[model samples]
Target: MRFPSKKTWILLGLSIVVILISVSPLLKDGFPKNHDSELYMVWLSEFDEGIRDGQFLPRWVPNVWVGYGSPLFNFNQPLFFYLAEMFHLIGFSLVLSVKLTLILATCLAYLFMFVLSKQFFGRHAALLASSIYIMMPYHIGLMYERGAFSEYLAMAFAPLLFFVFYRLGQKISYKYFFWGSITVALLLLSHNISTLFYIPAVFLMVVLFSKKILNII
Candidate 1:
């Protein structure tokens, strides 16, 4: 396999550094000590059972709210827990899976920011933007303190959605439209609440960016 160039390596190292500094508090020694973590484990325990019963696509988490379960799965964000469950299914422990998901989310956020920013701005600007994305105050709070895993994962897709939108605007073609639709779907699946807020931002970008919205409409 070919190795990355020195510049690639440097950017990658910067991404890792930004991610680590953002979540440094959680890495002090152990997992987060909080009610949310316990809730995650409980949800995963039931999720594992459903998977064992051949319910490959879980729509309702059967016992989450003190045994009086609602259709929480139907509305809850699936991407983060889906990843964590995949880890558990593949033999990693539940808690470790959650930690890994947070780290993976952090990495993907930086990488995606770098890609989207580089597409419009220069490499130096992209690196700076990606670093800022990593160290955003609310982002750090979510991963280190609040433990809102799925919402945190949603951050990476925000820029990617705009990037895909730019591509679709660049050419009124089938392929870009398809990919743009898929990106929107992924963002919605990751976190519906974030998607709701993203809608206006997307339209605002359409208005601001060289009037690209005209091409699509």
Candidate 2:
């Protein structure tokens, strides 16, 4: 493996600092009290319990819907909860795990957006694009106000999906194709609604870059 240049490290450090600053409120005492914050916490708890009880892909969450047990995971996105659960398994509190999930997602959003933009627009523009993406009002609201964990996670993966497809367009390789499939699958697991919105955009990307794709096949 090759080490990144000093410039790359600097850009990465700056991006991390910006992302941390944007989400610093999450590190303070008590939860941020967003619309769906408590709801996600409950879901993460139940999901963890379900996993402990031997349910790998838990669809039915008991103790919800007035104890009737809603099929929440079956219909809703499960990626964010799964990520948070990994943090919980390592001994973090559920609240901290949730917060960590949000922070990790923001970091990923910055990293992927930076890489994707850098491919076409050079490092400086990539840094600007990623900073704007991380600090955008709606993106900030997703974590601190709306608590839309799944959607926020999906947003992080969206640029990754695009980057993968862009690479596949540039060079048709099994590695890129495999990762592209995984990215799409992750996006679907992250947020079905957002996946729906992004599907057409991905298709358009494929269309725009079809010549190379066609040549490789």
The deviation in Å at residue 74 for candidate 2 is 1.2
Instruction: Give lDDT: candidate 1, residue 107.
Output: 81
Q: Per-residue lDDT of 1-217 in model 2, one digit per residue for the tens?
A: 9999999899878877898798899889879988999999899999999999999999888998889999988899899999999999999999999989999999899999998998889888999999999899999999888989999999999999999988887777899999999999999999989989998998888768767666776
Name the 10 consecutive residues with the lowest summed lDDT in model 2: 208-217
Task: Tell me the lDDT of model 1 at 187.
Answer: 85
Q: What is the C-alpha lDDT of each candidate?
A: 0.78, 0.91
Candidate 1: global Cα-lDDT? 0.78
User: lDDT: which candidate is best?
Assistant: 2
Per-residue CA lDDT of candidate 1, range 1-217, in tens?
A: 9988999898778767777887676575567674376677777777777777887767777676677776767777777778888888999877777777777788888888888899889988999999998898887767656767778889878888888777665666788678778878888878989999997888677666634566556
RMSD of every candidate to native, in Å, equals 2.7, 2.5
